[model samples]
Target: MTQHFTAPDRLTAKTGTQWWRDAVIYQVYPRSFADGNGDGMGDLEGVRARLPYLRDLGVDAVWLSPFYASPQADAGYDVADYRAIDPMFGTLHDADALIRDAHELGLRIIVDLVPNHSSDQHEWFKRALAEGPGSPLRARYHFRPGKGESGELPPNDWESIFGGPAWTRTADGQWYLHLFAPEQPDLNWDHPAVADEFRSILRFWLDMGVDGFRIDVAHGLVKAAGLPDIGGHDQLKLLGADVMPFFDQDGVHAIYRSWRTILDEYDGERIAVAEAWTPTVERTANYVRPDELHQAFNFQYLGAPWDAAALREVIDVSLAAMRPVGAPATWVLSNHDVTRHATRFANPSGLGTQLRTPGDRELGLRRARAATLLMLALPGSAYVYQGEELGLPDVTDLPDEVRQDPSFFRAAGQDGFRDGCRVPIPWTVEGSSYGFGSGGSWLPQPESWGKLSVEAQSGDPDSTLELYRRAIAARRAHPGLGAGSDVRWLDAPEGVLAFARDGFVCTVNLTGRLVSLPLPGRALLASGPFTVDGDRFELPGDTTVWWTV
Candidate 1:
């Protein structure tokens, strides 16, 4: 791969008591990030080609979604081989090169590690199937005997998170559990071999110079003592809102404690981040309790509405929970699994029943820009999802025929269906795939996306991409931005959120009408134009401004 930009090794800077506390990490969904080799699918080479871009964007790290060897049953979440890279994404050499390239650009790399389940095509699962019931190989997974007069019924009433029954009967009459798609079998975390195997996998990547890992389904690694029934319908929909027997069980903490030891063993402050969906912020804090993982993604914040009251409540609760555990609160607005915040904010209610509509994009972009500034100004690390910096809205108009998300066909109700946010991002304004690749993209880019391409927004100061670049740069330069742990809630009007951290203050106006708010210091950044009169500034509706006190 041709090198774009290089810098002296800065991995050592990542060391310190809590480097992750206020870090601005960028999430790169590999399949949609960029494509290399004209295959229409993003590869490690594509990521390598874009390292300079991420570096210039001023993010502390790049958290890559899964690109491991898989059946693509769930878009690489189903891992067939933990150590090898899928041919579509490139070889192991490409992965190593990407890691090396990222480090040289002063950017850390965090790859996804899925331990909750493995693709049925995995050698271990294949062996378990060939060996049949009562085989020792089956001990590595959640294999069990069927329950019924003729063993025709499922082992339990537990439903798959993706829909349907969780247990699938093999040709041998035995049943295995899969919380997701049947192709992705849940692993038996109780087994020592499972733990040992994962530890070995962690070491393999760590040895290859990876900075850290984003543990997929981090909370589901350990299920309840017995394979218990959920005993209710739509159990998947209750995830993160209510506790289920299969999720957020106390048993998972033990596994993380052990993994934390392995991470601490490596230099460069190797870390583990949990993609956990707990019932409460306190439960989420359990995953990052100093001895466990280093950070846990705060989905509550991501799900919060644009209303000031809701956003402030979530922020206060999140900070309060993490403070006790001595873990930094992590904030994220969007990811590959959910609706993009730009489109989400456009709807006054936040989540939409239908798809995007007229007047939605304008309102959404305004709120999204305000929300991005608000999230970045908060005291903690923030995650920037790919394409979000370019103000990409969710592709809600995607035809059902081209849908690839497993949840689209399986899960009913309001859960799943993540394909809209996973569309390939536009690079150049004019190309078959908007310069995403030389060939047709896996998912079609919207015709209007040409106006939102990186090339079009690169130099525009008012553009979302430039706003993100400035916000990140300011965060890196300002001592009070990313390193602080708590924000002192400043008294403000009912429809505004005002908080001061260290010597900096941020005020966001969420009200429909304009409001005048006192500024503590010189203006550092503002989401939009504001009127200043004396010590008070007129804050426009859905605007955020940062001031250096």
Candidate 2:
């Protein structure tokens, strides 16, 4: 049996305090979220139609992935026009209407801002190419002469994050740098024009009523002086674990500080979030200092294993690191970039975030639910990836021909398997796209997904969807769940984790064998069935429970 709670009223647009400090923000991948025009791809109108569902789901904000004008080279991350909406996604009028509709429903909007690079077809890049070498326009980007006698080799040894050399030679015999795909050219942040232009861009959107911006590749904005060589192999493996000349540079903090000042100028507690991948949690905290951005995504917690010890260590270290900066720690389980947590937990341990092999489905889902209970109980703001509430697993069997991830085409590239997690969500039990749109989905969905659709789970008490709704509502009603600074750890078995926050307690059992212990308090919620025996209760393996003393 599943517990139930009366759904809370719609969230207010802005709370009396800093809403983002402990808000639950949902990430909507626009390309696959919904489609209103039946064109098969999701659009702003599709998202507009789904606003009611999100409002009913109990999240405070919606963080939209890029919908800006682009050639779809790298899926809108490569921006050609920062101010215009992509034709496929609809017009500027549609964006305005969407923002208005969201606000009316008390949902704040956070748009993604990709400043680290721009589409090769952007006006600035085109002009730089036309003006040839030494052109003033070329100063806005990292264009340099190649090495060797004939200038045949790339300017430096730096490699593209998508595999192959980072430098691409132009017809004019000069090479340009791109950290990701060749179509996305890295910007020269040292150039004053880059800074001035982004400031103008920020004001443009803020004036249009956007609540905030999610800075993409936030750590890669400013490169090391002289474009030094990393002089290493398998460079992609070093990301988020070791420092490099091109990422997490000290100068990046200055850029965020400037953006933070602009954010402060706005009303309604507008915020800026950094999608920075730093080598350490302490270093990640640097981006969220009082004078800098409001929040940085806690990837460290997202990548932790299912083990109790590992999760506890990450929780303690993360909180300790953010305590000094006075920034609320952000917790996230799955996102657009990595494998879904539901599927990741199903497989064997040590696979980390990228798991290519399949695992036991039932076991994976059980642990995933247990993990969710644990995550929501922690003190801080939390991010819910699209479709995660439905316990959607990664669509791991997409054929190679249908795959569109740029990394998939390049050898030695970062795991090209991200497409597995970006499939359009199923909303109904039957439809060409499972109620995602009138037409077929851009990526094929499994036949088994019909059972997982929102329609299928709406009234079912044991559904994953219901669990999320209850958990979120519980979090909102309880004062100790969110915005707290720390948690008090309680003594438990080696593979079990128990903690208290105010009058609430969360206990997770990670071992395969059931454990008997004294009842903590009145049971508020449990991930699975439990057996009560006198003063003690038997907690099943891979389960979590919430208690209210």
Candidate 3:
């Protein structure tokens, strides 16, 4: 027989170093977050202007997507120069000012570091292309002779994550590998010069006083030996869930170990968080080993089906995996790449293959609120994607002509178009572009977003924004929330999840019918209001409540 948990008077230990252990970090997609210069794109100045807002929101840090010098091939993920700021975003001085402003507000800044590849227009890639096929410059990238008699075919049969063949032939008649878009070339990390250059890049940013780096494609830096062929199709479909030759290799750990040493040299406990996609939760944890990274995003939790048992299993596995590494499990529900959880959770089918099924938006918003409250109640750090607090739904009906994601254009096998999630956020209900900036937004926002605008919901107690604010405030004040990693499971009926974290008891009802239960203590916060019937309470479906013991 299994033991059930009760409201406890005492709490468990909350141990970890640095602020990231129980911190709440908000992810800002710079191009869509705000437009500071009225240039139709979010820039460093925009981020600087919004520092106070983030501070008021009670976030410990801000993880910015790439704003480095780039051609915007993959929305800044294809870095042309790691040291310089893109003209479209802002000047280098603006970045400095933003960092200073964020730090002053007690909000740490984490920038994206794209280590796996670089823009084709980058100096190194240009030199490799100009120096001809066998030149020493070619050794910095994956350049190889063709396989066919006329050397016409690619050297390997690897598929790009974006879609299509991974190999592209240059004017010099040699094939170069790019795991994503053809305009982005994969770097050869085995070269000593490549490693040294990236180390210097890290130092350059660290010296600039930025708090940390979010390493993109952190697990794909080192490829499998001999560049073996996957020998199968639809490789991109297997990302994050299945093992592939190009990702989650053992050699990637060595590179992270070296980077960890550099982070330790900094004074402000600067950290490195990995956007790694591994086959399993335990495998992803390896990136955050004692001598490696500080944190690894729990993708398993992000992709888990919206079910009680599935979520419980993922939470358990995530916690178990991180226990040995002594690293905090980073929880993320949505990001720039994936569809917003509001729309995703609303769908009857939660799988990636069917992300765009028309579903009940009302039901989705309710479940999203409940899910967010549940995630915030758990131990370790949590990440709130930009606009999630506003309860923005994915813009699934964007015109095909304006869609920008490479995967969307490739028309290959993928979950859905990513542009739906990257629409510029609405700040006000009256202005064009919804006050994202003075100018037009880069991507069109839904006209119906007025009801969800910050201005519209700012004063409403029932708004999703207010709920997030209250939840975050409660997490900070309550000793029970966001403190310990241990969770005491309580016996509950099917379609219900009940757990005790320290002195707090969180109960979530996922079933259709209302369930009556005894109150453990006074209610601190709840996703939805429940009816109280004497000593017992009526918990409505799709609601989560936090009670202090």
Candidate 2: tens digits of C-alpha lDDT, residues 12-92: 434457888888999999989999999999999999999999988888899999999999989899999999999989999
Error of 2 at 4 (Å): 38
Tell me the spans in candidate 3 whose CA falls farther than 4 Å from its real position: 1-17, 413-416
State the lDDT of candidate 3 residue by residue for 1-549, as single tens digits: 111122111111111246788889999999999899998988888888888888888888899999999999899999999999999889889988887777666778899999999999999999889888777878888998889888899989888877778899987779999998899999999999899999999988888878789999999988888899876656766777777778998999999999999988876678999999898999999999999999999988998877889889999999999998888887889999888888888887455623665368998899899999999999999999999999998998888888888777664636448888899998899886888899898888888888898888887999999999899999988888885678898988888899997789999998857998887788888888898878889999989999988
Residue pairs clashing in model 3 are none
Cα RMSD (angstroms) for every candidate in the order listed: 2.9, 4.6, 6.3
Give candidate 3's whole-model lDDT.
0.86
**Model 1, poorest ten-residue lDDT window?**
1-10
Candidate 1 displacement at residue 149 in angstroms: 1.8
**Backbone clashes (count) for model 2:** 0
True-structure RMSD for candidate 3 = 6.3
Ranking by TM-score: 2, 1, 3
lDDT of 3 at 21: 85
Candidate 2's TM-score reads 0.97
- Looking at model 3, report the run of 10 residues with the lowest lDDT sum: 6-15
Top candidate by lDDT: 2
